[model samples]
Target: MKVFVFLTLLACGAFAQQGPQCKAPNGGGLQPVLEEFVALIPTDKVLELVLTAMTSDPETQAVMEFLSSSEFYQVVDLVQSQPAFKSLLEFACSDLYLDAAYYFNILAGIFGFPEVHNQTRAAARTAGFRGLLLDILELIPVDELKALLDQKLKSDYYLQVAFQKINSDEFGSIIEALQGDAAYNNMKNRLRGLGVDVDLIIDTISKIFKP
Candidate 1:
């Protein structure tokens, strides 16, 4: 009986040294449990709440402090060194995130897609084309925008369409009108008024129309 008790104690000590297993048959780790809890939340409301918090002084300050911390830099370095982190970084920097609110608003409109006078569209249109263009340009990085345009312009279909349009009678008439002495002079005057060098404008347009 004494020998049996000693062996049992030794086995228990070995088990403790090996570490006790976390045996939750239903839930696994803290991450999985937190993810499950978050899944229950209305994400739209949560997003709006988070945005509101970030805009507040306290929350922004807290975020700035954490971002400037050595701990945050260590985490960033670790994440960047991981191979899988590139994919996540790409996703985070993608158009999906840049236009997340736009996509969500579109999704919201789908419920009432058949209905007229969508407030969202109306509000956007009311902001005016130039204002909207500026807002969109502000959101996109200059290099990414340039690369996207270059790729699109390089496509066979896009080049074909552009060639066809430029060869059309309407395009011919537009070029003729723009190239006329009176029209060209008026254009130069207008450009000069807008602080552009008339000589520079003429030189640029001349190169564009040159064979």
Candidate 2:
């Protein structure tokens, strides 16, 4: 199980996302709706799709309307694991795929939870939260990121290389956010000993938020 790092985000941006775009001449290729939520993806190659998505989506408004409370995050969680995602994950598995615990660690780092609700935005609504995602990441702090990295290493050796590029101060914030939690730090220390730089974990989270 390797903890995929921030660099992967840029790659994810470049590739990874492949979903229906617009209604295609006859009103097709829309996001899957079970009643539904919107996740935008463009048909372009080598482009930043998430940024494009935040601007024009209506499902976002639908999500926002139902957001605003406990159920809000719940829905985000629901969306995170939407069965469709299993297929997406399978589609994306080639770049980095970990089985067992490594996969769970990566899942923890992902922000499937919604940040807020009822806040309307006119910015393309389809653009998704590019900046907001980055800002929210600082919200997780440093140590937790380190601990997460450790979990990744325990499962995936290749991730040790990924950990080499992060910055320390950034990682510290995650630790501080964890408030010296024993479990979190224990994981961090273990990873650190393996030469997994705390900075790499920070960089990955930063990218994930922005990605």
Candidate number of the best TM-score: 1
TM-score of each: 0.23, 0.21
Q: The CA-based lDDT of model 1 is what?
A: 0.32
Write model 2 residue lDDT over 1-211, tens digit each, in one string: 0223323321222111222222223221111120021112112211233233334544433333343345444543453344333333332232222121223233233433332111112133223333323333334434544444445456544343224312334433432434344444454464354333455545654543231
Candidate 2 Cα lDDT to native: 0.32
Candidate 2 wrong stretches, greater than 4 Å: 1-134, 139-142, 161-211
Minimum summed lDDT over a 10-residue window in model 1 is located at 113-122
lDDT per residue, candidate 1, 1-211, as tens digits?
A: 2212111111111101122222123223221222233354354543444344445435333543554465544444443344332332222123112111222223223322111111111112212222322332233343443343345445434333433444556444434443443533443354344333334333322332222
TM-score of 2: 0.21
